[model samples]
Target chain A: MTKTFDIVFALWPRCAQLDFLGAYEVFAHLPGANLRLASEHGGDLTGALGLPLRDVEKLSDIERCDLLFVGGTADMSAATTPGMLQQLRRLGEDARYVTSICTGSLILGQAGLLRGRRSATHWAFLDQLAQYGAIPDPARTVRDGKFWSGGGVTACVDFALELMADIEDPTYAQMIQLYIEYNPAPPFGSGHPSTAPAEVVEALRARFGEKLGKIGGVVPTTALT
Target chain B: MTKTFDIVFALWPRCAQLDFLGAYEVFAHLPGANLRLASEHGGDLTGALGLPLRDVEKLSDIERCDLLFVGGTADMSAATTPGMLQQLRRLGEDARYVTSICTGSLILGQAGLLRGRRSATHWAFLDQLAQYGAIPDPARTVRDGKFWSGGGVTACVDFALELMADIEDPTYAQMIQLYIEYNPAPPFGSGHPSTAPAEVVEALRARFGEKLGKIGGVVPTTALT
Candidate 1:
């Protein structure tokens, strides 16, 4: 019998839904993949822009998992409570693979999971990774050791595909891609700062910069020496 | 003040989550957009692969909407109930635009909304569109009058961008694309049958074909003459 891979997603209120949902779509198809959603408080939680996620398991209740994933939130403070960080540290240390998408990397970093490791996050917040002792990689997805991260909201799909390839095989990942019909055909070419129009990128950078500024920075309490 | 667009998603149990979630991610960002998730029975609904969607409104309670959207399901019978089709027909007629992703066109077609119109759906089910009087278009996204459809699951993002461009403008849609960082970089080229390895395509076709066969096809009770 195939070994069941217990995969848990640690989510919080107002988290970007697509950050994990995109990956969830891909990972749910993997053979023997057992998926669960957990939050700091558990129960029904509203995600970004009023998306509802129900019956979430409390972070404290999950003893361990094969893979632990987290998605970014607009308000990082909600996910950075000391209790939440401690729980994340516990889960991350025991998981075979630790992963995140979008600003989720920042949460992982705050938990001291990304110290001295290369990671990726939303392009707007890439520079902030250093605050948590993580080396920020500008790639859409980055993998170092057993820690994996993806950039921005939609990068979850790409990150999951790559991780799936690593966990299973390229053929299996490719099959999942085909099953979801993930052939993307974007109508515009402004997904990244480098490729987006200068004006568009600058405007978004300013807007997101302010949001991040309000959240400030939390010291990585578990930073490695 | 900008006019609020009442965008309603008509969903059912087992409907592909990404089919609506991808589009929802985009639509949620639209200026003056009011998004609502409604199911045949309302209340908490479990979607594809056990994704819980909470606080969903019942279709019978929604009077009308600016745009009515639907996503595909693994088992079409669940979405083809007479009561559900009647509600869809009512909502689609009043909405300014009628849209779908993946096999959702099948639902709209059965609601008597796609007769004699060009539409697109998942590659595997493209041929089935003719049964409901829809002229199947092989494009990734197709727009006929105010009826828009996208191919397969991942096409939801592309379709939404196109619809957004129409609802607002190209510049606004491009800005949203950048915000979501939707520049997709699929790790595999097997998202479609045409580009996938022949063996992989054959295998998936066989599998999906069996599932579709088991669900069988429902006669378009409301198909236009």
Candidate 2:
């Protein structure tokens, strides 16, 4: 009999749609995968880019899940709410694997889950993880025990594929890769800070650095390292 | 002044979310992009994998757009409706570029927009494009005049980046690419039939071939070559 895996995605207002959507597409294709999207309040919410997401399940209603996933959000205040963090801490304890994409690791950290664990986040916010006792790793995808994390938005796709291999098998994951035609032919070589032009990197740093400060301010006094 | 490009995505029930979401993430960052999502009827609709999409604009209400995009769908029936085709034809006529990801080319073909055009679609459906007078191009992204098409689902990201380079400039597109951190590192190299294991390819072909037949059944008599 095929074993059904209940995978829950914890989302919030202004969450980066692609951060979770990329992984959602991958896990949705997995045989016996039961994917659910949830939020603190549930129902409708607007993505960071104003995309409307509807029919989200409430976090309080879900009892437990095989995997608990969270994606990045532009607004840190909504993600760091007391109720949201409480749910994450509760769900993360029971989930077979606790995972995240981009700055989502920061949320996991805020939930008091990433302390002393090596995790990954967006290239721009890698250093911020240490504030929550996370040993930030620069790899696009990092796996330390059951806490699996992906870097940036697009890396969620890669992270999910790798997680599938761990949860199921490598062959199954490779098949999903072919199905999605994920042979990425990036038009340019400027995806990372290391590869992007110095001027472009500097410009984005100035923009994202301010957002980083906002994220830092939201971290609770008790959660800080 | 940054010239605002009014881009419209033509969505339908069962449309693959990732097919357009990948491109949407890239285009949403474009300096002057005005993106909108539309369906035959304005309201909420379920995506191919049961993801809820809300506040979709009505197709008939949109007079014209700078670019028209359609993504692949699991159920092609919703895509070939007379009203849907009519709107696509009307929008494609005035749009600066008519674009699609994955099997969306098949929908464009039914709308009579792909007649005698070189295009691309999902690898599994490439040959089927010939029935609609489209010359199937194996390349991941194809552009013939103002009609741009991407191969399979994930190719939409590459297609959008290339289109950005055309609409704005390479540097601008590269900047957007960096913002998304689109450095794709596929955990495996089985994205295409040529690279995937023969057994895996055969399994998917058998599955997708049944879907291809359903697509063929829906092609209008006048549209077929």
Candidate 3:
């Protein structure tokens, strides 16, 4: 219990809020955890909000992490980079527990770790799994062996809770859940695809279509209009 | 409509998530609003659960933003530098909206902006307010003319939603509440000090005591504790 749990997470530009912090909330607050935000560069990174990121650690040390988490960023192009893809592929060999939030599963997919594996991703990017010939699940959390994942931005909290269960005792996870007030009463019950409004669903479809199409090797949308 | 609302949030090492992203979610996703995260160093700042942050812009061009937000960061030592405080005060003059998450109010307090102003912050840090002579309000969100502030992590979200009523159409704010699924249901039924279990309340006090004691110039804990 005295030793810190070594964790490494990928940091990029334009990631959604819940994607990063939902999980961060559970992990960083764990009693004896030593968390590090590993980036390509040292120092702070900006979030999609106009804010300063002062917690960036070096990416060169990723191999040392016991649990490695990959972030699903807003900028899809960053995930498509050969360098990033290769690094992710290499990460598979080193990571004990590999997980993702939102479209981060796509980065895992692009890394070739998802081939023939079952996983889940952000509702917006779930279809991207098919491009890698992997089975996609819509569950808030999907755990297929060592590959743990969440479905959308907010789902990360649940995923991390489950991860905490897997990493530690279920009792501890349950205790933390209570301590953090994990019981959520979502006002609208619209976090899922089924509950969202038709217009909202359509907007999601219109927005997600091209991102999914790109992995099938189709040319992505050049303009959103 | 002609103005640009590029809100840059600063992500510092060991920064709290709710303070940084709580307000960002309300403003960024408001319908018809164009929000961008200006990554100070150009990558995601990892938080509580090892989630990654992807930013849309960089801090090198801080002038482009209409609002700038900084979250409560653990390493206040680094931000206490004279130039840093001066830079923030300067941003307060240029930016239309300048805010903070959680203890982020302390940064503003340090910048000399909260002098004799009625503001809101996480209850744990209420004592810290006296350092800057900011009158702490127990409300979730307090509005003193242009300075919109919120108490603690989750309160930032509520405060942001309330502020959006002014900056965005009220209907749009409601729509955003619908979109982001803003209805919160805390299972414990205790987020405020008045209703929380005594142990839980004490735990909060113990954990945040250093923040209360250490961040002296911005907050003097003895008076409030």
Q: Model 1's CAPRI class?
A: medium
Query: How high is the TM-score of chain A in model 1?
Result: 0.92
> Interface root mean square deviation of every model, in Å?
1.1, 1.1, 5.5
Better of 1 and 3 by TM-score: 1
Shift in Å, residue A145, candidate 2: 0.9
Tens digit per residue, CA lDDT, model 2, B1-225: 288888999999888999999988988877778889999998998898878989999999998999999999767788888889999999999999999999899899988899999999987778788888889999999999999999988999999999999987887777777777788888988888889888777666655556555422343334332
**What TM-score does each model's chain B reach against the true chain B?**
0.93, 0.92, 0.81
lDDT for predicted candidate 2 compared with the true structure: 0.86
lDDT for each residue of candidate 3 in A1-225, tens digit (9 for 90 to 100)? 777787777766555555666677778766677777765655666655444556577676566667778867656664456655666667666778888877788777777787777888766566667877779987767888888987756666677878887787555555455444344433244455566566655554454445344322342322211
Q: Write the per-residue lDDT of candidate 2 for residues A198-221, one digit (tens) a residue.
A: 877766665555655542234333
Candidate 1 residues lying further than 4 Å off, grouped into runs, are A205-225, B206-209, B212-225
Q: After superposition, how far is residue B213 of candidate 2 from its true place, in Å?
A: 5.0
Clashing pairs in 2: none
lDDT of each: 0.86, 0.86, 0.62
For model 2 chain A, where is the 10-residue window of minimal lDDT?
A216-225
Instruction: Report the candidate with higher lDDT, 2 versus 3.
Output: 2
Candidate topping DockQ: 1
Query: Which wins on DockQ, candidate 1 or candidate 2?
Result: 1
TM-score of chain B of 2: 0.92
Using lDDT as the measure, what is the rank order of every candidate, best first?
Answer: 2, 1, 3
